[model samples]
Target: MTSGRDRLIEAATRLLTESPDREPSNRELCDAAGVAAPSLYHHFGTKEGLLDAVVDRAFGAYLKRKRGMLRTGDLVADFAAGWDLHIEFGVQNPVLYALMYGTRATSSAARTADDRLRKALHGLRDAGLLRIDVDTAAAMTTAMAVGCVTQLNRERRRADDPFATAMRSTLLETVTGLPASPSEPEFAARALVAHLEATSEGFTAPERALFQQWLRTIADTTRTVQDGQHQ
Candidate 1:
């Protein structure tokens, strides 16, 4: 048996998909759900509350499928795949995506997606692949991705639009400095630090921490010089 709450949710979802251009009224939703307006207020407190529930339900399903994605150890590929998945979700569920991301409403799934991006960037940082700090990389990547998806959605384009790929590659290249020249000593230094941290066993905890710090400082200094030279 469908509970009134479930029925209301279904009705709202249907109205969202069908109307896409307008907000369905409480009366419309109640009539569609075969429930009274009081029931919606009783269950959700307000219309926005009901909308939040719908977004959570939809975004949660998307996240579940994302969690099932196979993890290849290649962090770059994993990051690309995740970006594509996000674009795919937004393109497929334009109404839901707009509600969750384009509107003022908050969604935990959106925050979880941001967390996942930061975690992926951290993995790249550990591998000496990121040229920028994790926080900056996350912020730039998120902005680029959201902008790309918003454009695609606004233009009613497909997920496979070339703009999406171009934006992804551009943001990633800027973030990771991919295809680094062999002469970049900073890369070598960071890589060495990562390897030592992963495999070396003799150092005490404080010693290891200090050693890692020293290596990162040298690498960061070298990187600053390289940036200056490029300009």
Candidate 2:
């Protein structure tokens, strides 16, 4: 049997899907759920809280699917799939996507999604396949993905729209330096940092920390030189 809380969520989800451009009224939600106003407050505290729960439930299911397929050994491919999945989810659930990520404050589900991306980027860094550090790469990739979703929502485009495809390729190439090998010293330095992070048998904690900083300097210096060359 569907509990009153579940009914409210289901009604809100339906209403959001039905009118992606509008928010459902609390009275409308209560009417659809066949529950009183007090029922909603009792279950979710407020309308915004109910919306958050709806977004959480929907996005949690989406993340479950993404997590299942994001670790097939090839981290770059995994990242690409994850990107596609994000855009696809946005296309399918524009209102939910907006609720999940369009706010000034980050949602818990959004943070979890970013953590997954960072974990994959860490793997790529360990394999010497990333030109930038993990955090920078994650930020760039996420910014691109979110911008793409926002654009698609504005334009009412499909997930496989050419614009999305081009953005994905461009973002990946810039962040990961794909097709062009990570042959630079920066890539080597990043790989070494990853290695040092894993093995700590010989050095004390402070020593390991200092050595990692040195490796990061090497990586950052190479990146600076490359940037200067580009300009």
Tell me each candidate's TM-score: 0.73, 0.72
lDDT (Cα) of model 2: 0.77
Q: After superposition, which runs of candidate 2 have C-alpha atoms over 4 Å from their true positions?
A: 180-231
Per-residue accuracy of model 2 over 86-114 as CA lDDT, tens digit each? 78777877788877876512667677777
* All candidates: CA RMSD (Å): 13.1, 13.3
Please name the candidate that would achieve the greatest lDDT relative to the true structure. 1
51 in model 1: Cα distance from truth in Å? 0.7
Poorly placed runs, candidate 1 (over 4 Å): 179-231
lDDT of model 1 at residue 203?
A: 87
Report the C-alpha lDDT of model 1 over 1-231, residue by residue, as the tens digit. Answer: 999999999999999999989989999999999998899999999998899889888877777656744443557756766777778778888888888876623567678777877888999999999999998998888788778888998998988697887787787789887742322355345544644554457888888778877877776677567668979
Model 1 — TM-score against the truth?
Answer: 0.73
